[model samples]
Target chain A: AQRVTQPEKLLSVFKGAPVELKCNYSYSGSPELFWYVQYSRQRLQLLLRHISRESIKGFTADLNKGETSFHLKKPFAQEEDSAMYYCALRDPYSGAGSYQLTFGKGTKLSVIP
Target chain B: DTAVSQTPKYLVTQMGNDKSIKCEQNLGHDTMYWYKQDSKKFLKIMFSYNNKELIINETVPNRFSPKSPDKAHLNLHINSLELGDSAVYFCASSQETENTEAFFGQGTRLTVV
Candidate 1:
């Protein structure tokens, strides 16, 4: 079974500090990883995807197939960056073959100004 | 305009009552999904539909049925809801192609007392 693991339940960082939210996955085939963010009282939205290899809102994640990790990182955290972050993995080989996404227990990020 | 939207941002109902949450997406994506966020903030896929066809149905109870009337709308109906069903339900849509990000709706908070 494909699984996504986000170890931290909560993370606090001061404004301008670096932030790293760890994510690991257990999947056999080539994986597609994504980071989704949900702000307070707002809908969840896609922050970035590993396959794109492009940074969004100063956040970037690299897929490490050997380690089975795709950690989200930002050089400078802002107060507005505080939100719930979820790491998801797409399973293309499910019984339905619909490419369902398996998300991790989200990590709440608190940026103190 | 909201790309993906779910009705009844908050729902409070009795344990035995039945309720339905409606979702619609104007993104014109081919795939739509229902995800549940538990008390621990763990997100999991409950169902997936592509072009109004059932594609992925997770190990959810039969009481939980997803109906997609058209390509743009997917509704989730829960029968004899239990207290354990108290959680936030999200509606999301995405293109079936690779590297495309899924768009999500502001979740519906369902409290089954």
Candidate 2:
């Protein structure tokens, strides 16, 4: 079965410091990856996807096929960056009419000012 | 208007009680899903419905049931809820074709006492 693993349960960083949240996946075939964020008292929302190859909120995640990783990174961590972040893998069975997502235990990022 | 919505943001009930969480999506997406987030912050897929038909049902317990009256509404009815069933339930929707992004509703927090 395909699985996503986020190794960090909590990460605290000073404001303006670089932040990196590690994510690794186990899959036999090409996998689609995404990063979702949930701020305090807000719903979980999509932050970015590997397929889009676009940066959102100064965060970017690159799919590394060799390493089987899609870690989220930001050059400068802001107070607003503190949130629960989840790394998800799209189901391989999603061919045409299916949409299934498997998510990892989230990493709580705390940006201290 | 909210693209995806779920009723009763907070539900507190006792064990062995029956409860239902309602969800509706206005995005016109063909696929809807229910996810459970435990205290450890692990998010897992429980059920999925596409066009009012069950497509993906994870290894969730039989006490948990999902109902979709129409394409845009997917409700979860849990019978004989256990103490372990306490978690935040999230509803999400995505376009069934060529779409990897999913929009999630504000989650319903279920607390089984």
Candidate 3:
């Protein structure tokens, strides 16, 4: 079974400070990792994916297979960047039996002004 | 237009009553999912459907049933709603293949009284 673990329940960082949200996963096969964000009153949306290897809204995540982690990073956190972030892993070999994701308990990030 | 949409964005209902949340995606994706976000913002997958067929059914209670009429629509029907059922339900869609990101809806907040 593939499981995602987000150790932090709440993270606080001052504006302009660097931010890192930790995410670790357990999977036996190749896994696809994703970062999803939900801003206040907004819909939860995809922030980025490990396969894309692109930065969105100044946030980037690197999939460290050895560490089994995909930590989201932002060089300088902004007040508007405060939101709930969730790490999700999809099983590549679930086949017709399963295509669901194992999501981590999200981290609530607060960028203090 | 929204890529994914869920109806009754805010549902306030009494316990023991039955209710349904509707979800539709305009992105032409083949896979859809229903996720429950609890009070602490922890997300858990309840169901997944591909082309109107069940793919993943988590260890959720049998009272919670998901029905997909087609590839574009997936609805959730809850029987005998409990206080534990109160949460934000999000609908998402994505390509069946790997390397694709799932797009989520704004979410339906179901409040059981």
Tens-place lDDT per residue, model 1, A1-113, is 78899999999999999999999999999888899999999988999999899999999999999999999999999999999999999876553437678899999999999
lDDT of 3 at B52: 43
The candidate 2 chain A region of ten consecutive residues with least summed lDDT is A91-100
Evaluated on chain A only, model 2 obtains a TM-score of: 0.95
TM-score of 3: 0.96
Model 2 clashing residue pairs (backbone): none
Interface Cα RMSD in Å, per prediction: 2.1, 2.0, 1.9
Clashing pairs in 1: none
Over B5-110, each residue of candidate 3 has an lDDT whose tens digit, in order, gives 9999999999999999999999998888899989988899888888646855547999998888877899999999999999999998888887677888999999
Clash pairs for candidate 3: none
Better of 1 and 3 by lDDT: 1
lDDT of 2: 0.90
lDDT for each residue of candidate 2 in A34-62, tens digit (9 for 90 to 100): 99999999999999999899999999999
